[model samples]
Target: MKNASAINGYEMFVIQMLFSGAAAGFIYPTFLIRSTEGAYWIPIAVWIAGALLSSWLYSRMLARLEDNKLIVVIRSSLGTIWASILCLPALLFLFGALIVMLRAYSEIITMTMLPTTPISFLNGMLLAPASLALAGMMPIVRAARVFFLLALTCTLALLILGFSDIDWTLGTPLLRTNGDFLLDKHFYAGSFLWMGFTITSLIGSYRMQSARRAWKSYVIALFCALPFIAGYVYLPIMTFGRELSQRLTFPFVSKMDSIYHYWVVFENMTAIFVSVTMLYVLLIMALQLHALGETIKSLMPRAKTGLIYVIIFIVVYSVATYLSSWRAVEQIVFITVGIRLYMMFVFPLLGMAVLAFAQRRGGKGNEI
Candidate 1:
């Protein structure tokens, strides 16, 4: 890829924030509420901490290797065989994320807006962003910039509008469970919420001006997403209480429905919330498909981009449609949480080890 066509730090920041923020709109809150029960804040904190640590480590690796893509760094440091082996999990993690999120968003739409509309139709609508992705990374990044401001405005508006119904007292017993919750098997399951940081590895090769600036953009994006994520989980608990919030399909949407917007045209703000979130989801799916295409190109340099996209679209659309029910989608998502956790934490450390080994063998000259 030419340096001129690559995305800058601000564009990367916008894309990452939109991708991560989309998780906040739908799945993350549900997982946090389910796993932590009354102590959802503890898990949320853990996920954020994990995200920051991974981002820092990833940035350090990017600086040391000076490669635009993590796959290139891995291939350079570890050779083709080992690098391909390592990349398999990362690819699966990306594809798994695509499947889970595609179904999750479709489920949300069916439950909220189009009760009678088939999920197959919703899944097909999602491909709209894939068309942009087919044009290449620049289009996806530019689209992210366009959608970022509008998404941020609508998200903040919903949060501010929902504050009127927040019952702070419902958040009692902050530490309902003991510290054991931190070590619980499911603690890291929330990692999916913060997996947006992985975009650094995916897009790092896209000509970031400075590692320092790129890191700053990453940190800023995380902070930008904090309020929305925290509110997505906490606001609902504060509004509906722990038990009821946990029971609802989407407590955040429920919270939005409870709010009355006098000046707004739509009687229920949940529709607007869904519309904005759908945009976010579309961008995320585009990025995922883009990542899949890039990974395939990296593996088979001679492969056609059109064929790669077709395969990705087929796999994603087939899996998403065949899931048949929300419960099935939930099961797949739960299974992939482990894979996501591995990619988020262990994969980068492995890359660090490869870099260290390569540096020891050839010193600075062989770093890239």
Candidate 2:
């Protein structure tokens, strides 16, 4: 593993973009399409604003701890018992996310390209990320840079192609929103798409990286990802209309399958779409696994780190491999909505509070 000092804000940006692409393509659009009767952009706008606020607060918290990383500061300030208690939800959210994504993509591959393939063999894709996560952050960052270029280029091309047959009429109710999605669970379930900052924050030791630089990287990446998220939702609605788009499980995949441009050489756009998305998924999985492993190590500092990662890989792989259906994956996402929200909105504020209290106590002791 290269030193943590070698990691930088740009690397974090690439990692965030990878996470956004991975979530945006497969499951998120369906939730957004179903969440509101008004313009799909309303829910998206609301969520993007919320994501920016959450990331800003998180960056400020990191800024306050100029000398130590979040995990180390939390451990010293809150004590091991309290820090473990605080981070329990983070652990749950990461683990649940990993399972949902692994199974969801595995199901997609089965339905789209490999009807007769065993799901167990498909889930084995996690093995690559698991090995990289165990190797550490720099390795993951290096891998993410490569995947980002390939995945981004292919995804943008698909989105452009999506514009070919879209009917502007089907996109009616463009500026309307009644805040109906506020009551819908699925709206909140789509939070995974905007959680790049939270995921990167868990990678300890920013070292020489500043909070300002990190926040800038995150915001830029978020804007860069806007089209993917917007295209994934609106393209399908424009192509098939709202009523039909919501009914489809993987709307973007269906959209890809429907495209018939002669200039496009690939006979099966679905296969190409899935292949590129797999690259995004693998890198994001490594990020999640690394975050989960880091949290566990902080909580149990004496435990063997390799053993922790190995056990994590086994449990996640086994559960994901045996998942019965796509419905089950969605159910898991629904169940974790509360955890994800707390991680996004509440966790950073709580961490900041703890840090402030710690700093005050340290000041008093110094004065004494």
Candidate 3:
């Protein structure tokens, strides 16, 4: 090899996109957002199906390119003329989603937990770390790994602390079928959380160095994800029956407080636990910002990509800051996901078919 770069582009791309890509902070909130709309069960089930379809699409995108995040893959194979066109919509949607998360999360803190604190203070408090992390992708990823572990441990603690108190009787007879309206609601809610994982396949382009790099990564990733998914699923089932679970926002947080521990230091352990969990969410947003920066630099070399990242950062925070409450943020979240469905689904199929064509032509396709 003639002098490989210090941070291989693939690794760099992966590092930036990995921390938050899989978790998809903006997209995951859609479950709650859609839940607010009243379909209750259908949206969740649709979401679960979406995750499966997304996984297939993701795998195909992986087949389309050797490495680099989706943005790079598009530019390389599709050509900048076409790629840039495709990219514009992505930037607005993804960037908008990021803002929605910022606003919603900040509101969650101020409204639910810190009623006395000013919104500006809450936004600044959260933005400082996100800004610091976005400035350096590598350190931010490392921090995310640490935060992931901490979040995992805290989740386990929550399970142990709260499980016994959950009245098993309360959730009995999980009506295999909610009424016509509610059945639709349940499916979409289930799927909404999984939909955020689509970015993993996009970023997995870089993480998966080879078809057979290591089994451990898959195991570890799966293990980590199960707890996160199960915990969310568990809280709604254990805390509120299907009917009430459908009605609540932040069901997990409500259940945490319902578990009474007289000796426990805080009466509202949910707020503390939830606050910590938001750090995990911040790690996700930082990663996306970094990926956007790297992708812009790779494709549009004349423009300073960091400046683009800064502009995006400003846009996301500005929109978030202007949003007065979490409810408005929630509406934006679902609509975004609904809009992404078409692109997210179609892009992978196109990439896969073209890549297959490239492979048949001996792994060459108008290399950028």
Candidate 1 clash pair list: 68-205
* Per-residue lDDT over 1-368 for candidate 1, one digit per residue giving the tens place of the 0 to 100 score: 43312456788789778977777777767767766654667667766788888877776666666545667766766777877898888888878888888888889888888999988888896578679778777777778888899999889988888788778888876777666656644455567777776754665363234555676787898887788888898898998888887788788988888888577677878888999998899888888878777776776667898988888888888989999788787777768877887777788788778877776788656775
Instruction: List the candidate 1 regions with Cα displacement exceeding 4 Å.
Output: 1-6, 175-177, 183-186, 204-209, 261-263, 363-368
- The lDDT ranking, best first, is 2, 1, 3
Runs of candidate 2 exceeding 4 Å displacement: 1-6, 207-209
Better of 1 and 3 by lDDT: 1
lDDT of 2 by residue, 1-368 (tens): 45443457688678788888899998999999999999888888898899999999888888887646688789989899999899999999998999999999999999999999999999999999999999888888888887788888999988898899989999879898889999998898898888888987877755325677778888988998887888998888899988899899999899999999887888898999999998999989988999999888977889999999999999999989877888888998999999999999899999999989998999999999
> Best-fitting candidate, measured by lDDT?
2
lDDT of each: 0.77, 0.88, 0.54
- Residue 50's lDDT within candidate 3 is 62
lDDT computed for candidate 1: 0.77
TM-score of 2: 0.97
Top-scoring candidate (TM-score):
2
